[model samples]
Target: MYSSIYGGIIRHKFPLYKPNVNLEQLFGKHILFLFSFLTHENLNRAIRGGALESTRDVTIANREHLSDYLKVRDEYLYELDVHLDRFLSSASKAKISSPFSRSALRSILIQLTAASKCKKGTLRYWPSAGPGDFLLSSTGCPTSAFYAVVIDQELSQCKEGVKVITSSIPMKPPLFATAKNVNYLPNVLSVMEAEEKGASSSIWVDEEGYIAEGPNVNVAFITQDKELVMPPFDNILHGCTAKRLLELASKLVDQGLLKGVATKKLTVEEAKAAAEMMYVGSTLPLLPIIVWDDQPIGNGRVGELTMLLSDLLWDDMVAGPDTQRIPVPYAE
Candidate 1:
């Protein structure tokens, strides 16, 4: 049961979304059930504020006008499933070395598409939680529609003991970084930018110039003095993989392995001066970022602290007790 404040009143309820069965069998069931669960979850969360019930009603009414929201959500799910199956099947037969194979990327796309259908809003995922990796555009699909996809290792490369992970191809807006339903453009561009800049990868900046994230990963750094640094949550995407790393960091702090973990607003300049840098996501557990914008980060190489955290994160991801569970409502 998840609980939060709404209208200054405490609201508690079981999660609206939950997977009834393994997500691998998503296409075998009715997609509307999934959308309804997501819708209920978001609404309940919004209602926590207590004054937004009327607004919620209005939003639902407006959503109906945009088209059959449920149908659209189903379509998105179907498309995502199709893509995932294709990617995964192909990957199973291919010799892919990327952290996340094309199949993983497709799975994330499905999740994002489903979430967007419920909110009628748009969402973007960076390659490594830096800036722009591969973005999905669903803003034009419906007035009350949202689309998002995760950027992972399907677009990365390595060289000279440094692994450079780029986003997509052709770095530009509308076709690249601009928010939309399609994501391939930015994914391609971010990777190209990394290659051209001679950096391991490119970090994306939001409208305010704050380090938003990476193409398909989340950014984190360790200061020269060995302090863990990350951006505040307000402007960055909420990365599940990153969240896991933070949890691990908390445990490390408890065990006295790390000095501490800090989540604050950090500028690019501050990050560049940090002793070590890395990116985190579902696919790439932890990847060192030795350079940014052609400027050598820290020692112009992966930092020891960065590697330590990476190892810890990787160990947990591969064998941690935490099992992936879908929210209720989406659950069978």
Candidate 2:
């Protein structure tokens, strides 16, 4: 498994410590702590009751295991209400309103759960201002968004071999790209567009005409000279999965397993001429683009770099955090 560093320190380098044997007791304590934290009044009461003073001494003993402590802290943060209506109203006024349907939210959450190796579930949809903004602003929630839409045939042919899945209706960008709050729309639309074009999915273009990413995934390409390249973050959503792949790419470059991948504002012509192209995201980890806008990408087939990156990404997913343990089921 690939290693990660936070704050310049390798995560794995930290010594591991097993949790207390009495899991129930530990969990109870966690709940109590969370309750106190969530209710400031209660915390003040606890402080007066000597609870805070006693805990301060105990906290020092667990400082080394701060990561685990932070995990528990995050759980409490998630428990806080998101005040969705307030956010929605604010987003609407800002012209960043979303057209997310309940079905779309359910489908996306299910897909993410599966992709992230979590349980089957649905997530709450919140309106976002644009691609750069996090879909879910609440702390400890899925930061990404989902879109499901239909792409024009012309755009679908940009990538060869990838099929698009079209809906009976011309799926609007709200279900796919252009919406700030929902993220899954792009993935669904990319797939729809690809199936519609007799390909697998649609290839996305940034404002500069360079390949930004696929609907729900990020794009990576190897130039004719075998230089690996990924799109800069300016034009696309900062995909968590994509971030991880980039991290892996850095490692691969160090080992000479692959050329150093660079992010830049690439033009459409530059992307189309690349020797290889692939899509990366939560669900479709790495899908090679054999064609672009009816033109053959590379040799009109999946390239070797695409496969290598896909394999590397899969390994990381298996070793990553367990997203399912949080259990964000559909709201009743």
Candidate 3:
């Protein structure tokens, strides 16, 4: 994990307690508070909400922040520029000022990825209002802060289909939904509702009865007429992967594999009648949805074109141009 407060990277294990041996040599006795908070008793208290008033706990406890996720492959960060752009845009919308410049942030992310030696995993980062007193507003924060961590994960193309149900949880307002902030209660509740109903995840429908998005991913469909259609992004999050899919899926149109590619409103009835359905997100890239609300989608099997689109996206992530993939500078 890299913290602007730490001013550098600190190696730690799953529980995020251990500081690197060099910290003692570098900071001497000054960094003792960091270790004190990492102790089992202190962590337990924080987890139990007994220490919610602590300044270091405010960023997460208060839930005033923004975050973004990126896929890392072969020590290469995929679509680094695109993800950074979205992150900065979200920060602007959330009124969170970044402590570092864009170039410096990019360099930090690359260097952190390299330091972790994680060939294939995820890079998750957050910009917060910074540690401050327990208050609803961020006025008490001295300055905004940034933190990022490299997670070791094994992600692959999701070929098999999964089931989903329409979410009953209230969807976030367009203002909040369009921004990738730390407010995800509705998303979590929707996913939980899906699990309770024996489905992988849930979809959110707008108040106007149009498909908004999935719990945390964007939804797309292959229409009966073979058109690749997704809900317009005006009211939902403008997903980077979904946008890329739209761009890459155009190849299918050129090759006569799909009729056309477009983004427009999709009602539940129209979406359910589609020949194929899928969820698009940074991690999933493309996940086929074969069933919704216990009813079969199309032939109740993964669509051939769905796999084709997934392969296109997977290939792009694995071997896309330099513009989309940034090579990480791992230590030799």
Output the number of the lDDT-best candidate.
Answer: 3
lDDT (Cα, tens digit) per residue for candidate 3, span 47-124: 110111124534665888888989998879998898899999999999889999999999999988887777788888
Residue pairs of candidate 3 with colliding backbone atoms: none
Model 1 over residues 1-332: C-alpha lDDT tens digits?
Answer: 01011111212344343546433243223212122222333445421111111222212222211100011121222122322332333223221112355555445444444433332221222111111112333232222221122111122212223445333343333222212122444655786777775655666665554566776557888877677878775544445557667777876677766688988877767777788888876445567777665567777866667666777664553344424222212212
Better of 2 and 3 by lDDT: 3
TM-score result, candidate 2: 0.46
lDDT of 2: 0.43
Summarize candidate 2's per-residue lDDT along 268-297 as a digit string, tens digits: 788778888777654455677777667777
Where is model 3 more than 4 Å wrong at Cα? Answer: 12-57
**Candidate 1 lDDT score at position 329:** 24
Report the CA-based lDDT of candidate 3 relative to the real structure. 0.83
Candidate 1 positional error at 104, Å: 20
TM-score of 3: 0.89
**Best-to-worst ranking by TM-score:** 3, 1, 2
